[model samples]
Target chain A: MLAAERRDHLLELLARQGKVVAKDVAADLGISEDSVRRDLRDLAAEGLCQRVYGGALPVSPAVADYAARQTVTPDGKRKVASVAAGLVRPGGAVILDGGTTALAVAHALPKELSCTVITHSPTIAAALLDHPRAELFLLGGRVFKHSAVTCGAAAVEAAQNVSADLCLLGVTGVHPEVGLTTGDAEEAAMKRALSARAADTYILASSEKLGTASRFRVLPWEKVSGVITDADAHHPVVEQVKALGVEVLTAS
Target chain B: MLAAERRDHLLELLARQGKVVAKDVAADLGISEDSVRRDLRDLAAEGLCQRVYGGALPVSPAVADYAARQTVTPDGKRKVASVAAGLVRPGGAVILDGGTTALAVAHALPKELSCTVITHSPTIAAALLDHPRAELFLLGGRVFKHSAVTCGAAAVEAAQNVSADLCLLGVTGVHPEVGLTTGDAEEAAMKRALSARAADTYILASSEKLGTASRFRVLPWEKVSGVITDADAHHPVVEQVKALGVEVLTAS
Candidate 1:
């Protein structure tokens, strides 16, 4: 096969399986592993995919620049955010994650709802300014500009000071096997720290994030209490998640 | 004089003197003390001025809504912010307060300069998103919607975590006699806490705030390192502040 054709085929496999193993792809195409690795490296260099140890994973489309990500599954983000916002019981403390989806969740929260919101995102904190009754806490740390969120030792240590009833965790990708993931390692660590401070954590997955894998893993299936998503209800991956004994909360 | 005339005259005196003593106003106008008190009450009810123990003080225009205050003293805020921004030595840590002037300071900061910024204001933190090299820390606390900053006991506790090289404090009022003040008691406490965390704290005083007096006292004159202002050079308040052994940094 031509190199361009093989690269297209690799992308198709990644979309379908959420990852491409070099050994499997080489055998399936009757090509050498070296050729497959070279293709993967080229793709990674172009920012099309994340090159892994033995293969490649898709880079998260959700981590695009703020303006660019606004067009990435916006309606689906709103639907998923609506469901995530509903999880907040009045008067409860919630740990909110930072991302476009989480920003959507901030917009989706009721104006009169009097819950305490704790987050490390300045953007989220600024969005909640006009919220009449909701009390917000912005955790301090070194900022991660791409996500407009705070991470690092300071943020993690600050997270330990609060006990939250629920955490709405936003990640770039959610796969049945690879679990929840994002594009940055420090952000993944911060999310883990936030989850530990909460009694229950729920995944906020819009349609595009499903069946995709990013560079860093966040939580395993057992770590999250539920998944709030707007993905197709009948999708097999949704069924696969359900089969793992996890509650799947679907948005309309 | 007519009641309308008397009230207007009272406003003028308050503007010139930063406060109105009922006894003095009554004596000056040849009116009953009761009549003067009634007029001051009417003015306070209209939000025209803040009624103090024995008279009234001019209300802070800085405490108005963000949009309304945008048109108020913009040039002064920018000039004050320019001088305030210059105080941030490259590679040093700065504690930034809330309000439009501080937002201006965030804007005035050179994007190429690298520094660590700690703040309790989401608006200031949001403004710094485009700053390429400044590291920001947003202290977690209950959101103060009026000023788009954070305060309360949680915020005061959060202030103790870090030490900064300088603090640029924003307040509604800065009077030599009243010391430093703001509209809300909790916000005043938060500012005091922030001042303690920094080695040198400079007051961000636009022209409007130079001789004003708000309800809550923030800090005494002895506590602050200097005052940055765009108030007239020969303005008695500026001269008075300078005479108190406080460094008066003027922004052209």
Candidate 2:
């Protein structure tokens, strides 16, 4: 197929699935991964798609723009958020990552359950206001407008000081081969730093993010305690993740 | 129904509907409005609900908690917030105080407008994620969980470094006798410090707060540039505020 044809096909896949992997696209189209990458780069330059580590996701996830990401698979995110919120033990210190999904988790928290929530996302901290029993600690740093979260050195320093029982990390991509990833390098560093301080960490991703990859690698699968998603436990990706020894939780 | 049972029913209504007016509850339950008010007052004392002008809202807003306040008179808050947002000029640096009303102002901001918003409320910063043109700066300090904003020495020091063109201050009470007030002393101090750094400061309060009094004073009338509310421009309270040499803006 012509490069233009391949690009069009990739765009179609992204429109349908919310994400596209270069390797998968290459294999399906009988083309080399290099050719798929080149197509993705062109699409990203045109503001059509965002190029990730081993694939390309919808532009919204690639840029860490919160509002844009909110419209993609919102119900799925809510489900995942519900399951993630269930993972927090009462009275534990929970570290929440910044993203729309994490905001959902914040909303799903039981209003009467007491806990201390530390987060860099202003949105998540605000959502926790409804939980009368939550003690919120907002990490301070440079405000990243795109994601509405704090980043930079100050944020990392603050995360290092927190020793939370759980961390619900929101990421753009969760690939079996490439691991957990996000859009920005600084944000990735901040997430890693937060995970380091937590006793347990779980990635909250809707099924749309399965098999996808982003530019910045946040954590290897081994570091994550589990994967919480909206997909059924019997789903292929869920099975694959469980096969790796990470617990997989699906929201009913 | 017994008094305890009636109070339990009221709490249930507040939980489901977010708010319950005294008159309506009395009519529905075959009781006098005075009796309903007594029940609401009892609930308020027990920290189960917050008593507003003619009704009781969920506990969050009643207790100056950030999340609960979001559901109280949302339409009225939106009206006040729109007028407050209109006061901000393009390209100017604005300081926003932490509160449900200020969060509304952040949401009311035009998507295409370019400005710098410095805030201690992570919720406000997160709301600005929809405004692609605006730059956000989140001040760091001890997080005040009740209001979901940062307070204390660090937040005050950060506010001092910023010279904003305008500051939209949100408070719990706006009284002729007491001026602007809030629930916590540290938060009041933080608001005062933020106002000190701004060229013009406006208080965004709903009409229900017109004659209310809180525990801590934030600013005197002379220090404030204006009062924006959902009340009519010709209301006695508006006249009182205007007589103090402060501009009073009402929603149309």
Classified by CAPRI criteria, candidate 1 counts as incorrect
The prediction achieving the highest lDDT against the true structure is 1
In model 2, where do residues sit more than 4 Å from their true spots? A1-83, A141-148, A229-252, B1-80, B140-148, B152-162, B205-212, B229-252
RMSD of each: 25.0, 22.4
lDDT of 2 by residue, A1-252 (tens): 234435556775686467898887775554688988988898999999877788988876544333344455388988888778888889889999988888877777887999888889887777776677787787877788788799988778767666899989999999988999999999999999999999999999799999899999999989999888888778887888889999988886
Error of 2 at B248 (Å): 4.9
Poorest stretch of ten by lDDT in candidate 2 chain A: A61-70
lDDT of 1 by residue, B96-210 (tens): 9998889888878988889999998878888788788888788877788888888888789889988899999999898978889999999999999999999999999987787
- DockQ of every model listed? 0.17, 0.18
| Per-prediction TM-score, chain B alone | 0.71, 0.71
TM-score of chain B of 2: 0.71
- Per candidate, the number of residue pairs that clash is 0, 1
